[model samples]
Target: MSPSDQVLGTSVEAGGATGGDWVLHPDRALPAEPGVRALAREILSAVSDLPIVSMHGHVPVEWFVENGSFGNPAELLVVPDHYLVRMLVSQGATPAELGVPTRTGSGVTAEADPREIWRRFCAGWHLFRGTPTRFWMETELVDIFGVTQRPSAETADAIYDRIQAVVDSPDFRPRALLDTFGIEVVSTTDPAWSDLAQHHRLAAEGLGDRVLPTFRPDAVLTLTSPTWIADVARLGEAAGVDTGSYAGYLEALRLQRERFKAAGARATDHGLATTDTTPLSDAEATRLYADALAGRVTPEGSTAFAGHMMFQMAAMAAEDHLVMQIHPGVLRDHDPAIAAAYGPDKGYDIPLAIEFAHGLRPLLNAFGHHPGFRAIAFTIDEDTYSRELAPLAGVYPGLKLGAPWWFLDAPDAMRRYREAVTETAGFFNTTGFVDDTRAFCSIPARHDLARRIDAGYLARLVTEHRLDLDEAVDTATYLAYRGPLEAYAELAS
Candidate 1:
């Protein structure tokens, strides 16, 4: 066996032996103790095949509307995935070598061939060891593409050819794969100013019920954003309401919410640097809006106005019945050079320490008890899970704890999340698993991992005599399918 084979635990010859048999263990992520593992297996068996309800994600809607075949393994698995790009770049790989397109209109050079990119990825596959990205990619390769080899330099060409052939088939098209993956409902995030043309196309093609759009208005709320003026103007055009004044801007947002409702959107998503929700008085907010429109808003003014917008968004959600989803604490575009060259979502986003209890106090006090309002709060700060968010969601009728998000979406973190939140907020107050990914193929794998982790968590509860076996099974079903459905109930209705 060659050194590559030694790294991959497979036999390889100079003539390229077809890797090894990589089996996805039945209890891949379950507890190692026999009793707990057995119980986990039982719980997992009950919910493993449950249909996915992905209520919040960043998947491009055009893929489903177009129903086109994927181009290559690298495009399908690497270039578009920030998780992979970030890891590879951390290991001294450049975006250009990985076929990542530049935002400056210069296309990826010929040297960034798909085959070469796959080889680079294979060479660096060891870097993802013990990471959720590794698990997701392994599942996609072995389960979805039926690849029998571990990714390595020697097996890169063979694995790429195998995946390429699979993607070339009609069965691998986006719509077909949706059915194959048993995805019941998937939501794609769209800007408030979006036309949702692809969403409309999906509806026309009878797929609207399965694939839906989510309203994300962050760009318009950031008063100091480079494109804030343009985004607000676009919102005005889309809603047919003048947005020159703060009152008209609020009205434009309301109209856009109604438009989204008509287009089957059931939720509005907010990505904030802070979860602050201090509402400014009407006159104060109007002044800030005018300053922003004139490109004269200060940093302090921007922060104050953005917080005010979050409060106003909750009020609108209460009236419009759009479930509010807040994922705060991310400092996006951490590296300005990378962002300027490769564009946002090239994976420089980093998490900040967040204090959600006081940060969310104003909004919760204002609308927490509203009958029409529903909110799901997600965080990368584990400290907030038990100390702040869970306690808040435990009491607030409108607030639900969103699943472990972004950096916390790994197996151990998820397990910790259930342990921390379930004690205070309980299962029902928590929204179910959300595969918040743009990597479409990883959706099933991510959801599958969540289910297994939840099962393991519940299995330990059963072992502790805290839950009956039948009750645990039922809860597993809810966490896998019903929780998200109930959280976004308006969409189903």
Candidate 2:
């Protein structure tokens, strides 16, 4: 039998005043005024347990199939998470020592011990303080994993042992865990070169017909990133076109779209520094491709190649039934040393001031009016929510605004997102929350936060009589399930 924790622990010595498990008392979550809090609580209860519809996220499919005991608590929770790693790195910890993967075919995993990593991570728990990562980890440890005593160096061994014990059971496996979390569907990201054999295997084994893939061919379009030539060649082979030429390269991309479609891909994802899209004519495109092939493209030409490819992708979506997702404004791997030691996502990517107006013009102009084309744009720049994103989605027929992403994916962020987008674009113009995380176990936590925020927001609406309780219930359900299913259904199966 698996170890199960059933207590909401509080320790005066450790002081629960910290944000993690301390952010909200179940009762305190209601509101300041008793009557208002009660109403809010009632509203929140309506959507608390809706089945999760994860339209976007990142978790290895092997977790569901060969679900083994997660090696260690830190490996399960901290090491792979940049949200955790970046914070740790900020405190002078080195990624090399934290088992961060290396790009030069070497990895820090060699000399690292899981317990040592957890000890290091635990010592830095105080750094989390009021941050959302602190709150979520605290909740996961206390509320979910049954770790009552705050994680300090003293508690590392006990905590890891307990968590490992709990996870060793059949109940802790991926399918079982998803069941425990009431997940109905989960969409993972895959590159265009991916064969998706694992996804097919899981679907064949009957993982409740929920697990699926999203086609993310950023490596194909991101000429600035590594593996560009290989990615392009694979694109050509998949599409049965010559990738050596600009025209053939476009065909290769189109063919990969069909391949992903056949593999149950419902959407395509792109990671960019900005939402600004540039389109190039045939002549300009040919020149850029030639430069890229020759490894002589200037930085400006490289970025333009990405922008031009965005337009071409939109055109491909017009023909195929795939939804398009663009995750923009992240300056990936800002730390030179950490990036040198560890590859992409070694906890140094920072968000930038992403402008939607000028950045997205080229692609939007090309397909903004074309019916049957859907583009969902995501941004970490909260400043653009009401001012740029809401207004753009409000007017564009083919564009649907994605929710606040990455750093802005917390409960407060979700609430702020609704307040930001709903007034102008309205709820229908916005796709519901996508977890957008690589932490598999945290998917439930992310979605739960979104629902709680939505419920809390809708509860405010109901209390104000701006929305009826019945309507709030329906909307909550939609935000949790129907919205994602409708948004990504055709692309999946």
Candidate 3:
């Protein structure tokens, strides 16, 4: 809190003995069962340094194209990390102190040392204990930056200075780090109406082979979006199609999908309250479109239109090679005030009870058997993993279960998912891990956790002899890296 503590290069006493070189004893957190430990170690070694294929995330396009230095630690780490702020908020740490961008709030760093903000973060580091947050933070701190000491109130300033120095170095730029981190491919979610100019630039410069784009039409499809009708109209304009008719809307979507493909997008993403794969007749769809344009569409009508659109989008994907991904079961931005101020994805999104049994039947009925169609379904509803999702994916040629995500993106969640469905759906029936993050630095950390957790999960199977040790190691490595490339084939070569 004072300049007197500003010993930038000075050594400070770390509170914990496991500070220096504490690179998260990977797979050490799993349950201790006979033969489990040895098999886990084998699986971990197999996937220790495999390349990451991130098929879904919210990475800034400009970070790669612009390749500019992130200004400070708070800006790079705390400001964009929803997981960090979400945990911080739970522990009575305000966003203002953590340097979160908010509605006209005064952030810490009035003195602008950057180290002070990090010190504050370190002081509250205990709040993340027993959480995936702690796992990820420690991994990032040690593995990525080679920090020898655990972040604490005492060593916060010292570590901050070291990180600041590392951050400003040329090796820490987005593209450079992507290469260093062994990121084979990274994809970002973009609106269907987006120009994707940066993606074009990256492609033109050969960076497109790694930094890719995914079409996220959540805004255009969600009837709850304030500018739904306007968005549809703009979608029409962007796609060079007419907007006055229901047929024209479908045409617009097709054209936009083409445009996205041309702009280096090989995947389409939908985020909805549920996989409400309902069907609507042409007349009903036309009526809904008209009402939406007139701002007279009922909530029921909006839901119908969204459900209808899912089927329609699948139809498009059937014709194109674009992989369609469904992210269902989130009650997005539960905080009305936060929604009003910062909009969606401000760390207030909550998961709700969702049904996958009958909810996806209509869409599955329409598109599931099509050889040309592909859909990767993700759910917060773990109850469905074995009961519904596994059976469906096992049978449906086009369907693949997406990785455990959002609320269930933790280590336990990953292990539980593999245990629940891998027996029935098997490894090939499920798409592998996706970062699904807004934070850039956490990409490697997230992937590392998924890998280690998967290694540990497979180790149990190998120990039980449910799977051969060699195959378990291979599958674990695939889940960490290769499976993503296969699921997102067009994006990753």
The estimated TM-scores of all candidates read 0.94, 0.90, 0.91
lDDT (Cα) of model 2: 0.75
lDDT per residue for candidate 1 within 234-273, as digits (tens), equals 9999889899888899999998898888889989999989
lDDT of each: 0.88, 0.75, 0.78
Q: Which candidate is the best by TM-score?
A: 1
For candidate 1, report its TM-score.
0.94
Question: Candidate 3 lDDT, tens digit per residue, 1-493?
Answer: 1111132233323321233644445445655774787777778877878888888989989888899988777778776888887886778865556665555442232234456667778888888888887887776666555566778898887777767776776657888778777788888888888777888889989987788888888777766578887888788888888878888878888888888887778799988776787878999988888877777867787888888888788878888879999878888888887655554666898888788769788878887887778889898889988899999999998899999988788988888999899889999898888878887878888887887788788888777788898899888877887788888775321
Cα lDDT for residue 450, model 2? 72
Give the per-residue Cα lDDT of candidate 1 at 363. 96
* lDDT of residue 60 for candidate 1: 87
Local error of candidate 1 at residue 305 (angstroms) = 0.5
Q: lDDT-based ranking, best first?
A: 1, 3, 2
Pull out the clashing pairs in model 3: 20-148
State how far residue 115 of model 3 sits from its true place (Å): 4.3
Off by over 4 Å in 3: 1-23, 103-116, 491-493
Model 3 RMSD in Å is: 4.6
In model 3, the number of clashes is 1
